[model samples]
Target: MASNIPSSAGRNRLAAPATPGAATTTTPSRRALSADPTSARLSASARRPGGAATPHARAAIRAIDQRRRTLFTPGRTRRRSLRDQRETPRDILRNLSRVLAPASQPLPSSSSSSPHRDANDNTLATVPEDDDDDFLIERPRFSLPLQEDEDDSDLKVPRSSGLEDENYTAHSIELPRRAWSEGPSRLGRESMASVRFSDYAGPEIQSDDVGIDSALFPPPAIEEEDSGNVMLGVGDSPERLDVEESRRQTLGRESLFGPIEIPDMGNETTFLMAPADSPTREATVIDAAVENDEPGVFDDMDDDHVNEPMDFPESDDEDNDNMEVPNDAENGNIEEPDATTLSKPMALATNRGKRRKLGKKISKHGIEYPSLPPGVVKRLATTFAKTSGVGKTKISADTLDVIMQATDWFFEQLGDDLSAYARHAGRKTIDESDMITLMRRQRQTSASTTPFSLAQRYLPRELLQELRMPVPVPIRASKKKSRAVDAEDDVDVT
Candidate 1:
């Protein structure tokens, strides 16, 4: 019977292979004791002493047994499946709420909050779709306004303080130096003294209304005195008068001194004085006085005097005719001639020098044109001059040829117009416009031959005509009807 039981137990274990290995123990048949249900119960009762369990231990054992039952039973597995389904829906709702929630609310505090707390909180506070329409229409949240008093206080202090403390020191310093020490100052002083002396001597001297005295000197005493002896002192004795007159004349000469004398000619000690009969002496004296008044007179005179004989050989013979030469005098040691009273022949000679310079310049760049229309040549010359980048006085032969070619092309293109314009001007010439058109056509032709040129190839004559003519209004039916109505109204008004 035990062997059969063993076989049966083995078959049962094979049928239920999912049971724990510990539940299928192998023990010796000799030690095996089979007990009845009553004895089993008695043993269990003995283990519990009074057949009662302590509430605390009973609860603990019941909890452990419940957990085990839940782990093992298929029904408990079904309960776990239900729990998973419930958790999935909850997680989805939580994620949705989090995604839809406003960003401004403080992030849910992590301390006491569950991971899903923010989601739950957001869902509860979220407005429904129907409510949002009205909510969106409400005024948007704006930043808080700053106090006016605070802004005013900030602006006032610095501006008011700057205005109140406006006094600032500026220092300009100059170094000391001697005043009125130069030659100009000395001349000014001498002039003033001389003016004062003249004013004191003559009451008839001109005086300004401002009480400023102006000294006016009398003409030379020599012009008034026939004897050429005018006493400068009170003594009238012949010898004394002569000495005084001499002194006075010397002073006058010094007062009217001319430019500094030219350097002495080396080893030359000769004088050639103009004859008394000749007016050259008087002329020289007057010229010298006038030259003293003119600045830079000496520089001009030096060129003439230094090379006088070489530049003006004719002047030497004239000088000989006018002057009394001593046998001891050098050949070319002539006294300086008066610049102001230069003979008419000499003036003519100077003018001829200028004319010669002008003639040379003209020869270098003068343009000689064939007998064509007056303005035609001028216009051609002007155009070529402008295009050639050459001066008006120096247009080249090539430039002239270009101008002639341009003029010929212009006449061929605009012959009738050229004749009309020339007729109006009473001259037979194509003017500046003809030249311009020729240049423009040439540029166009050149540009057409070149790649990627911006120059206009053809004149837009039709487009230009259209632009000059006014645009006509389209005759629409509605516009015609309105115009008829307006005409009827005007007739009624009349």
Candidate 2:
């Protein structure tokens, strides 16, 4: 059986492969034993009994505590101080000296010898033995810096009947000297306040056999009186020292947040109470006509929509009389604004936005409404001007169509009249003679002294100016003397 036991070299706890009729014992490894949290190496020293873990501890220990919670809040119930356990305020005050005394301090030896005598028994004995109830401890004032040799033998005890001053110092530490206040922080520069812990840090005490070394705690560095930083004197209390400011300390609006801006509340502007969605001049005039109750009251106003018919509400004459504006009839009446005047401001204010939206729509969608192509009339007008011997002529958009109509009619009449005159003279087309005869007839009909003067109305000014030269007088048969006389003589001779 022993031969079948596994060796400890491989740290394995299983039995080794056994021969026939062989047996073995396998000892558990240290790691396998330590797998239990109750093992001596795994358990904390506090949990182990006698600072050592035993087998019985394994029964209660777990790898992770089953009852462990993330949050922990201990109970606040307390045994309370002896002073708090006392019944009355005067009783608590009567025993304050005993409560503050350390446990090591011996109890007061009373006149009646009792080792277990408490504060109440000591107070009762003191009251009967002595009638004087006044205290003995006198608090030393801050008239001078505490000397180097000074210790807690100084501070006055608050109460005294039971506890003695011997071996019972209220506080062990003594007050620091004025020079000892100088530290790494700006201690002396600031007023007595709720200061940092570092500001209170100063030189540590030297060897107890000797006293504090003055070299370790140096005097405060001298500051200029003109620099305005003040430090209290050794004898003076900080509460009584008054610090004078060079300038008044005040929080100013301009100083803290730069400058505050107050809005212009009383600014002048047109305020309209009425709501008008569409802003157009025609609507303004229409509103006026309605307010005045006259269909044509604002008809004289110049507007593009002036010719567009308006549908005025048909009212009886009695209603019109009732609606008549009272401002015209009564001398004492203060005029209330009519609807038209009220709408004027709103219409004017929204007019710019409407125009902007209109321009935006036209630009974005490229004029989707029914309309001629852009600049078509302009190009035609330019072409006509160029053809009529006036290339620099700039036509007005309002009068361009009218000018075109007049031009077409004028040319048609001139062409048909000239063609008729040519046909009457046995010709198919016009010659210079026809033009001269036409101009002479036009000049006579128009009562113009100059020949072809009416041609100026039809032709461009530049062309007519160039054609204003004198015409060659023709030698007519009526003007010829002998040549025309031969016609009379020839008729007589025949």
Candidate 3:
């Protein structure tokens, strides 16, 4: 039976073939185990209770835990001293001792120093605690360049109490001296007290004698108009020479040309005078007209018959004289309807007046009804209220009617415009594309106009998008009236 039992190689031969469709997975068979020695070792290590993989995994987990611990851990900080944090108000008297007192000398102890010492003793340079509390000098930390060396143990001093002074080993350090502190220069001293006024004065006045000459300022000459002629013209026959003297005066100073005629100054008229000038006394006749006294046009006409009124005969067969007669009833049992009764209903529904009253009777004999249905207006009003976030508003009938009429007027104008646009496009029916195109054109043309701005607020979001890309819109066709039976049966429950 041991010889007949199947070996590992025989068991491998009995296993299923590795088809392409079957999943290719590694199985621990002796053949595979012999091919890869490392995988076999790994498998053997995983099977054992104390494996190398377990130790390595534990080490990796420890390293990750350590990293996480370090990342989340908070650091500890040392307590800060008062000097390191913020500098307080220092006692100037205590600091002055450090500057002025000798560094080599040790400070006298409180027990050694006598309390009843002289008032002027230099050892009593320390300020009393009460005085220290009353006055404190706050100096900026960075103001002084020199600082006491930290390593110098002999110069160190503790905080002063009431009367004890500590030894301060002051260093004998030289400070840089500025040149400006020496003295003022000679030039600077002179410039300090002097004022710099400009030497430039205004232009010199030119003397009249500078350009004046003999031609410009000549000696005065007197005109001698022969005294004899003056006396003879004045004394001899003054009346007879008046005309000649007047003519000579009128001629003015005689030039080479003859006497010049004085220009005429016409009569001055007031503002109230007619604009047309008076006709001239001398008439200029361009053409002579011959007037015939005899009457040839109406020689046989009588003067007595001129004032008589002409009589017009009244025509009885004119179109305006013919009146429309009422039609007589043809059926006696069922009387024919009156023309007024038949037309009253049709006339009432039509938009006759520019503004039709909401609840006015259009017919002389009919029931009064509102032009716009109240239910439709209420529906529109509720929708408006909901959109505007106005909770439960009461709209008056007149106000609603006015709003409806205004809306109707606006729609009518829009329809007219759309009709015009359709006609321009060579189509009687207006489409969505035409509406989008018209609105876009209106926005572009009248961007600054009021109408476009108002329309923009009311335009739909999709229509605004369509304005950019004039895409053909899919219009849903309205459903036709359903059958009474179908409608009744198809009614929704709630």
| Candidate order by decreasing lDDT | 2, 1, 3
Rank candidates, TM-score, best first: 3, 2, 1
Candidate 3 structure quality by residue, lDDT tens digits, 224-258: 22232233433442242112122222221211111
Model 1 TM-score, all chains together: 0.12
Query: Going through the candidates in order, what is the number of backbone clashes in each?
Result: 0, 1, 1
Better of 1 and 3 by TM-score: 3
Candidates' lDDT values, in order? 0.33, 0.34, 0.32
lDDT of 2: 0.34
What are the runs in model 3 whose C-alpha is more than 4 Å off? 1-374, 439-494
Q: Give the TM-score of candidate 3.
A: 0.18
TM-scores of all predicted structures: 0.12, 0.15, 0.18
Write the residue-wise lDDT of candidate 1 on 1-494 in tens digits.
35656766775545332122212222211111122111111111112322212232223333433445445343335554345434555346655756866554544443334424544554446646445322333344343332333222222111111112212221111112222222122221001112121122322223321111111122223321112222322133223211212223332311111111212210021121111121233554465566456545543443333422432354334333233233213455444333312353355456445433222100001111122443556665676568787556454657665555565445434544555556676875765434334445557423223211111122256654543253352333234435545655665699
Summed over model 1, clashes come to 0
Off by over 4 Å in 2: 1-395, 440-448, 452-494
